[model samples]
Target chain A: MTRHYNFCAGPAALPTAVLERAREEMLDYHGRGLSVMEMSHRSPEFVAIAEQAEADLRELLAIPENYKVLFLQGGASLQFSMVPMNLLGQGGTANFLYTGIWGKKALAEAKQLGFAVHMAGSSEASGHTEVPTQAELALSSDAAYLHYTANETIGGLEFDYIPDVSVPLVCDYSSSILAEPLDVSRFGVIYAGAQKNIGPAGLTLVLVRDDLLDQRCQRIPSLFDYQAVAEAGSMVNTPPTYAWYLAGLVFQWLKHDIGGLEAMATINARKAAKLYAAIDSSGLYSNPIALRNRSRMNVPFVLADERLDKPFLAEAEEAGLLNLKGHRSVGGMRASLYNAVPEAAVDTLIDFMADFEQRRG
Target chain B: MTRHYNFCAGPAALPTAVLERAREEMLDYHGRGLSVMEMSHRSPEFVAIAEQAEADLRELLAIPENYKVLFLQGGASLQFSMVPMNLLGQGGTANFLYTGIWGKKALAEAKQLGFAVHMAGSSEASGHTEVPTQAELALSSDAAYLHYTANETIGGLEFDYIPDVSVPLVCDYSSSILAEPLDVSRFGVIYAGAQKNIGPAGLTLVLVRDDLLDQRCQRIPSLFDYQAVAEAGSMVNTPPTYAWYLAGLVFQWLKHDIGGLEAMATINARKAAKLYAAIDSSGLYSNPIALRNRSRMNVPFVLADERLDKPFLAEAEEAGLLNLKGHRSVGGMRASLYNAVPEAAVDTLIDFMADFEQRRG
Candidate 1:
């Protein structure tokens, strides 16, 4: 089978090794005579799997003892309402920093839910090209928490540093978690939809400080109650077991084959630098985001001539570099270099970019 | 691989053909160079898959054009909250018929959410062994909706007939959907967790009448708002793509191999009858559920001696009949013959039961 380099921003590429292992185990998981997809979530076999997955993820994030990891459903979209419903009880409000599309979306949901959300800082004026500096933030004194998007896939902007604030920090790290080393203890809650760096869509991994789980508003949905879900070990209902198992395999792959997140950071840095360097040197292509805020995971670049965009995508598809067409919200080409995407794929993309530039120059 | 007859109530068995197709396409789906799991929900390729799945489901159920089908996350547990949140507008009360464990659970959530819920009918006095007759239902005239569990998986009881009610009817068809024929026009909404009859866990299918989608309560989460999700074509968030794909495969299998719901009903009926007959004739084993309301999908039976329960389960597992242990709440043994479970498996189970009874009699 011919392997293709897939750069889909979310529901994106998975490591070939993990995919192959999943395939081998699809018919009968660990000689259990049934697919993981067919196994009972309460079965000892599946319980072991769910436990190991949480443990590995906890280790990878170096999550503190005070933090509770809950595997949930409804993607990051649910978290938009849940975070506020679970945190901003009664009359409290949250401070939001809008850096890109996802942040704007989260803010919209919080507002829609009647949460008194305050925009502490925003770089929308710069077309979401940069994150606001610490000085630009005007956090509310009575705020419940500070919410931010660590990396914006659509706008290709990333936070280079964790904000230093006394308030509880909540982040939508959907596009950035497990891509690099980070201080897990710095935040009150870090939630990510598990489609980018994680194995699959449909599973949202939420890590919240234990103390924060008790603040659920009276009207919050039972499933969205952090304390109840955390106590149930994220098995409040039948989980996406197959996705959870695949994610466990990914965590294993990252630990063994790719080494830890620290080593992963170095490799990710190299891939981004090489690709960005190629874009910078080429007169035919350019990335719009500021250098300091450019996302290492998702890099969106525009063709010198917009007319060549369709042809460039077609040619790239032919060359087996798939899903390069950027998000419709951001019209250009995006090459997402998640941990599953190897440096070799990035080199191939760079070479292909150079060739396409020469042919269309 | 040694195939087993798994009797897990939820996260249950899937058609072997569906699992095989998933395995074959694990690395590259339809030669698209990526697994369906890795495909973007927005891509044309994935959109087609999602559309086809919904289309096939609509065809199988003979669902009217007036109904909107939603592919959602969070399973049926989340729906326990969502149903009331979406349907029970301010000060609205719903009539609930409690036939079994699931109905009780849904009722509990509705009450917890402060929905003015009235118990229209309950089989609690009968130990959840039967469904309430139409004459027994005392539905309130001003009730927003009448809610019922089509089949109670834990108690192995089923409503053989749809409740005759004036109010819009909502049914939890989790364990019974696609196993038989039903009039979709009679129900205002039908929600099911896919793990039982569909494909996998984490994907919930909601079929709501177009007219009912308008009744969104002020506090409903956006993901739980049926109208919002339907308008978005269930793309309000990233769906469980792999589960949806597998469910589509199951739909195809039901349509082609089993020759639609009518034929599936006949097969299911036969499987249930054979097992029930065996239990009735044997002095050593008996099904507690009344024959009239006995579930055609899940047949829970208990050994007369009770002391042999553990040995029976252990030996059955060794013989490749797995997960027959009943729910902790209703302990003995449950043989769940979902659509995926072949009639031969039921015959095998009966044979094992008879042999075990003879040996221990």
Candidate 2:
């Protein structure tokens, strides 16, 4: 079987090693005689797997002991609501830095819920190609927490520096959580949809500072209660067991094979640098984001000629490059370089781009 | 590797055939050269998979055209909140029939949300051993809808008859959804967690009558809005793609291998009946619920001497009957006989029970 170079954004590529390991244990997990999917979340075997995943993640990120790691469901989309519900419970306004589509979504969710929300900072003036600098940001005195998207999957924008704020800081880190080592203490809450880097689509990873666990909104669903979820160890209900198990496999792969977040970050930086260098040097390809603020995780590019989009995607697929088509909201092409996407894939992608442009330009 | 009989109630056993197929395709789905878990949810291949799963489910239940089938996450627990928020937009009391733990939780969620809610009927006086009968069931005149648990996983209680009510009817069919042929037209809304009879954890199935789409509570999270979720075809965010794919495989297995729910029901009924017979005829083992209301999907039994509970569970495990310990909330023993728990597994469980009782009763 020929595995192609995949660059799909969110539900993106996973490490081949992780997939192989999961396949090896699909039916019976370590001869337990039951599939991990079939095992009870409360079972000792599954609990071990869950605990190990969290431990590895905490070690990788240097998460403080005061933070509660929750393996949740509903993706980062749900966290958009939960962040406001949990953080703004004490009658304070929700504040956000709108960098791209994802940050806008998070703010939209809060706004939809009728929360008093403010866009403390926005790069909308830059057509979502750049993130607002810390000096340009503003937060209300009543702001309970500052929310931002560390990496926007759709727009290929990322924050180069964490925003320094007096209030609790919340981050939607879906596309870049494990791409580099993080200062976990800087954020009150950091949530990521697990489809990209953690493991699979169903499970979500949430790191909530213990102090922010309470003060949740009144009259919310029990499942939406962070304190309860943390107390129950993310088993407030039946969790996405198999997905969590797979995430554990991924964490193991990262810690042992890839040598943790520092090493992963180095590889990720190099891959993004090579891709950007190729794009900048090309006559037919151009990315809009400012260089310093450009996302290491996602690179969105437009063809020199709009007519070349379809041919480019089709040819790329023929050349064993899959899911290179950009999001429908944004036309052209995108290459998401998540942690699992190897340097070889980026190198291959660069080669393909060079070849495609020469023949088709 | 040997696969033992798994009787977990929520994240219960899956069909061996489905697991085998999933194991075979865990790395490369149909030679697409990417795991289903790795594919973008919006890709043509994944979309086709999502659509086929829904279509197969609709055909299996004979769901009418007016019903929209939603593949969601967060299990039935989250549905507790969504139900009230979606149905009570026009502002009416939520009515409920409380039979067991799951029903109580559903009612509690509505109550916690500070919605106008009423307990139309309850079997609490009977210690939840019997379900409230249709004759005794009542609905408030102001009720937007009447909700009930079709089957309670922990208590091993099930409704023998759907309550004939004037209001829109909502049922949490989590543990018992595909165990038998269901009349899709009977209820206004039906939802089930996928781990039991569907495929795996992390995916939820919701079938909503078309009329219930628009009138939703204001100021709710957009993700919580059924209208938005329905319109997006459950893809407002990246769905639990792998779990959904596995559920699709399960639906196909049900349609082609098991010859639909009617044939499945016959086998399921036989399996449950055989086990129940063994329990009732035994000196030590006894099920609390009335015979008619006892769950066909989950059978919770207790030993005559509570001291023997430990030995019963220990020996059962040694005999390769896994997850025999009952839910911690109601401790004793529970052997969940979901659709995936084959007749052979039941027979083996019964044989193990008899052997244990003969030696230790």
Report the number of clashing residue pairs per model: 0, 0
Which 10 residues in a row give candidate 1 chain B its minimum summed lDDT?
A: B85-94
- What DockQ would you assign to candidate 2? 0.83
Question: Which CAPRI quality tier does the interface of model 2 achieve?
Answer: high
After superposing candidate 2 on the true structure, give the runs of residues whose Cα lies further than 4 Å from its correct spot.
none
- Which 10 consecutive residues of model 2 chain A have the lowest summed lDDT? A1-10
**Candidate 1 residue lDDT tens string, B242-330:** 88888899999999988999999999999999999999999999988877999999889888888999899899999999999999887
**What are the candidates' individual DockQ scores?**
0.76, 0.83
Tens-place lDDT per residue, model 1, A1-361, is 6678999988999999999999998888888888898899999999999999999988888888999999999899889999998998755778899998788889889998877889999998887887899888899878889999999888889998899898899999999899987799999999999999997898999999998887888866788999999999988778899999999999999899999899999999999999999999999999988899999999999998999999999999999999999898768899999999988999999999999999896
Which lDDT values do the candidates have, in the order given?
0.90, 0.91
Q: Against the true structure, candidate 2 has what lDDT?
A: 0.91
Q: Residue-wise lDDT of candidate 2 within B1-361, one digit each (tens)?
A: 9899899886889888988999888888888889999999988899999999999999999999999999999999999999999999899999999998889899999999999889999999999999888889878888899999999899999999988999999999999998999988999999998989998899999999999998888888877778788899998988999999999999999999999999999999999999999999999899989988989999999999999988888887887899999888889999999988889999999998899888988
What TM-score would each prediction reach against the true structure?
A: 0.99, 0.99
